[model samples]
Target chain A: MNVKVIVRGKAKGAVLCAQKPVNFLGGIDKKTGLVRDEKHDLFGKFIGNKILVFPNGVGSSVGAYTIYSLKYNQSAPLAIVCLKADITTASGCAISDIPLVVAEKKDYESLKNGQEILVDAIEGKIL
Target chain B: MELTKEEESALDGKHGETLALAYRILVAIGEATNADKLIPVEWAHLSGVNYNTIGDAGEEFLSHLSKDAKFRIKTTVNPMGFDSDNVSKFHLDEEFVTKQQSIRNSYVKMGATPSFSCIPYEIFELPKNGTQVSFAESNAAIYANSISALKTNKESAFSALASALTGKSPHSDLRDEENRKPNLTIRMKTEPADEITYGLLGYFAGKEAGSSVAISGTKGLDRRSCKSLCAGMGTSGSCGMFTLGEEEGEKIDFDYKEMARVKDELNTSESGDIITLGSPQLGLEEISDLVAKLKGRSFRKQCMIFCPRAIQGQIRNLGYDKELTRAGGEILYDCCTCLTPLVDKENIDAVVTNSVKGAYYLKTSNGVDVNLKSLHQIVEEETK
Candidate 1:
């Protein structure tokens, strides 16, 4: 099911990914390629292959750098979609060089885990 | 990717060493954040107090800046790494103990203040809002700045502090036309009807609605994945563990494993029944009061009290560590008291807390009947 999603926040657009499960709402310390928080659900797992989903983000300043590190290590996520597209995500996306998109209310919660994400951050859709 | 003349001057070590370090760090952070220019910052709530987290980076950085020492700006910093006492808790593993202590020693050897309370603002006043403040804070501090005080805090404290010390930070906030817009509107729940403490009320209000903690608004309230090993509870200052009346129930729900882990830590050893968390932020007044209360009560020795590291150091400075050590004063850190702290939960029955989050979590996490009294009242009832 290729669903086109639109989100209304700071930055809204579409990319090549759509409604992928937002596995965790934290970071994957791009430098070490390890999930930094010992308490997260996906604590030790790598974010290399998953279609990572989240609202904006919260936690360490190491966040943006971690994204860059992930990209450098060839473990970056396929795409990113944020509910609140703010500086934090913007900076992270700019560095990791990952495909970016924003979510529309029409596709926000409806994008369940395990779905493929085809997004256009500029178009603000997931098709 | 671009630097202004002022930024380049700091980067090229034009301003003194402290500012230079601040610039270097903030430049890295800004680049990480994809900002092309810097913003002005004066007051910053810097974290790096804890070791490990802010330990190595802080020690190395500060050691260099403060080394052949002098003053760039007489500034205050609230570091995130370990303070002295955090290094000495849960000595179950000597190796872990040694590592923690060494790192702590390194941080302190420099000029960093070991004022290990989450609420630096409570202890010392910060600059006012629209005051062009810069700060480095995580969860609670970020919320306090963005919502409680409506100030501007960067992603983390390190970023904020670096910017503040150097006089420049991210060019992305407030100035960027496209990014200046806002979203997410979280409503703190409690009314000011004397129904709850202001702090506790806000926490509960957010929790009751399963509020998502945000930079400004409320959209990210989802709690589908809070089971990470580090369940962080923010502090306003150094508070006792039994402090309560906050609203975490709506925000978090413990799983079966978490529940068990929660149950396990409530148990304390009854070696001589005179258990006490080591000192620094001593509830001495509370202790005096508690002793008075228990003058004629039973189980006088079956008492426990939480003492902070600052108080412990004071005791050591006063030549009393050996005496206090002999008096059965054990030590604990505030962070480890969360959902399940790998302690014996069954043996303990009473608790005393100064931190609203601590008291509330203990009561909510366990069926333990705890008290949200002042440091004095806690000592009084328990010691008495």
Candidate 2:
């Protein structure tokens, strides 16, 4: 499917789709890459090395630095796919050099947790 | 998106690794927002200073970037975790102090002014109206776009830092005149009587409006009320700017019910262990007004007032600081109520505050209950 490339990279991994918007700063554990927010649907699940999928980011601008920290801590997702890209997600992916792409509504809805996928952000495509 | 030769060269690392990263950030945002190009910015007011807000990862990132990056335009910064002078008085953690200092040093090394204020529009002289600047502090961005007649999208910490380094921002969103019009009109059914009420109105409007909004039935808002509105609007959602008068759009009513709903969410406690004021740090005029209100009266409980250090200096000169001190009000500078280390859950069960932004963060970020009251109500009830 076609996508909007945010950061240029290629990655293949199983998906961890979050139904709600993620707040990186407090919603995820930087050290463990686990969804720590109890309110989040993906609670207790790992994000590391997976293709993380969510609608977009919410909350503090510090979420950008949290994403950077996740990469530094060696717990970053292999790639990220979102429906709408807000400033928090865009800048975080940019600074961390994470593979990021924006999918259309239909494509986003089709994504399922644990589904194996290839994200070629460099080519702006999902396979 | 299009880039100038210089921008391309910088992006390609000719300007060093830091500049390349800065350009990369701008390019990514410009692309995501569908901007045709970047435009020059005159100033940048940045956030992400508080250690509590950004933590260790942010500190390391800033330290690495500050090694080579220098701001190209005028830049101001946000508040740190605690008041440096009153660290011992508050008994803030030693590790927190060291980390917070490192963050401060990083910004200073990057050639950013040590303003340590969220309300940069009040402390510094503004550029001419219609000028473009980058402001990451949410309240300041909204105030600039709506009240000061300047142009800016509500920037994030990284984007504002990128703008400070590159002296340019992506030309999109509120930066474009066409996007600045209100998409929704919020008609006030009940007149807002005070800053807190105006703040509630702003909070309700932000949730209901789109990118921009038109707020009718409110006029001649003083600086305090205006700042409160900006702060409340900024805290609730991503909505950036609001026009004061009615504009053609889908209309919604901000009646008594809406006001009560917002207040119900923020005000969680009947009474509080202490009283706190200032979210967007108080300006000189606010301090003067506060002093006038506290004439010959003392707070029944501990009252903490946060203001910019520059304003503190002016108030000190005018003896207002002395008078406030005499009235049992502890004046803290270079910090505000939101995310401050001073108001810990271990130290205080709940806080009484007149700021909507303050009440929200105090409860969620600081982990304490909030007793919300108008400034006038606080003065009348808390003083003896």
Candidate 3:
């Protein structure tokens, strides 16, 4: 299997395999499921379930609502896949009720958003 | 798939009525999220200031049926809105009082606090980064929890309330170690512009991305609450136009009832520009000052005022909203009017205002004319 890594870093915790994809529309609003902070690459994408692949979190607290709104609007990706975890994404999962997983640093380095990845949060494993 | 011992007991009438009521509410929330099974809660935050004119009827039932306010979690934080302090502070007036009271009284009988607004960050010292807890629907609270990644179950408002009562929810949807990882990561550096409200700027970026999402994000937000852009904001329109005052700052509180008295007298005829200061939910003296400002001038291409719908209505009812709206410049709701596509596309040149949040969001998102100003200074600048 071809292994590709985005940002090199150490991750702690479980890794889950993803079948779908979530786009990274940058910071998501919690109250409204809209993408926020035009500075982000995927600015203006109502992110739901395309396999959001990101290193960490950014932007305002209100973005949490946007993430939730994305879930409600059917815009959120199947699950949140991260190289490193951040509060923004965590908040999105918490409010959106979407599944979120993290990988070990070695796995996080080898992981890719589009690439098929497996993670076990309870056991803290990533593949 | 069944409730935990604590939850079952609450449902079975083991806990007191208060908790039972919250549990019932949580059940609905879980259903809405399509949670496979509820999970045992770590804690909970009771959100709901004054009751909306309408809300989850189930919560009302739980509140009534369970008077003892049962509790499954060892600790919880529930905040109410629109009490005397909120009424005085935010300017929720008589009509607001009556409407909210009727709704709250129903739940209050079950031990709900009659407060208003959902800025949970204000009252609750929630943990950050995966803090597990169940949270209900509230724009403000949602904002706080999501920003910090405080653990919360995105169940329906009703389900959270149910959980409050029963104390146990199905643990079906809590992300396994595998599913909770973030997939897409985006990073960018904005030319930190002057006069931009730091927080709102982040929001603007989210808004832009939201627009791009396959799903329409705004439509969903509307379902939650009627936004009051004008309610808690201030604006300015001298020479050009701008909103004045920050959502966070030294509060410029008002008495809405007093302002309503002079509601009939306010007009936005001031010529060169206009400046708004703080929330338009004002008292009588403030209205008198506005009417006086409009006494000798006519609105320009820069006719603008940032106000909540309530105050805007008062202005419109007094023959201002129509005049303003007809001029292709009217009040906005929920979110700021200027932030809307209307003004951003139109004549918003070299913006100046008192609100750091607005300044930050606009400057960062659109790269527009932005400046920071004090409420009084904005008025002075616009007229100059």
Best by TM-score: 2
Better of 1 and 3 by lDDT: 1
**Model 3 off-target regions past 4 Å?**
A1-36, A44-48, A59-62, A83-88, A94-97, A119-124, B1-352, B361-370
Candidate 2, B1-384: lDDT as tens digits: 899998999999998999899988998888777788999999999989998877788898899888878899999999887788888888888999999999999999999899889999898888899999998888999999998889998788889989999899999988999999887898878765689888898778766766799988886588999999999988776778999778886888888988998999899999999999898788999888988887789998999999888776688899988898899999888888988899999979999998998987887668799999887889899999
Query: lDDT, candidate 1, residue A15?
Result: 28
Q: Model 2, stretches more than 4 Å misplaced? A: A23-49
Total clashing pairs in model 3 = 165
- Model 3, span B1-384: residue lDDT tens: 346676667645565545543444344334322345665565544433222212233224334454554444533223232333224433444554564445455555544432222333333455656655655432332343334455453333434445554455544333232323322211322222212222222222232221011111112122111111111111110000011222222222222332232221121122222222222122223333444554434433353444432343467567765544454433432223223222242445445444433444344433354544433344444542
Find the 10 residues in a row with the least total lDDT in model 2 chain B.
B202-211
Scored on chain A only, each candidate's TM-score is: 0.67, 0.97, 0.57
Candidate structures ordered by TM-score, highest first: 2, 1, 3
Angstrom error of the Cα, residue B41, model 1: value is: 2.7
- Scored by lDDT, the top model is 2
Any runs in candidate 1 off by more than 4 Å, and if so which?
A1-48, A58-79, A85-127, B1-5, B8-38, B48-111, B125-132, B138-150, B170-200, B206-384
- Superposed Cα deviation of residue A12, candidate 2 (Å): 3.0
- Ranked candidates (DockQ, high to low): 2, 1, 3
Ranking 1 against 3 by DockQ, winner: 1
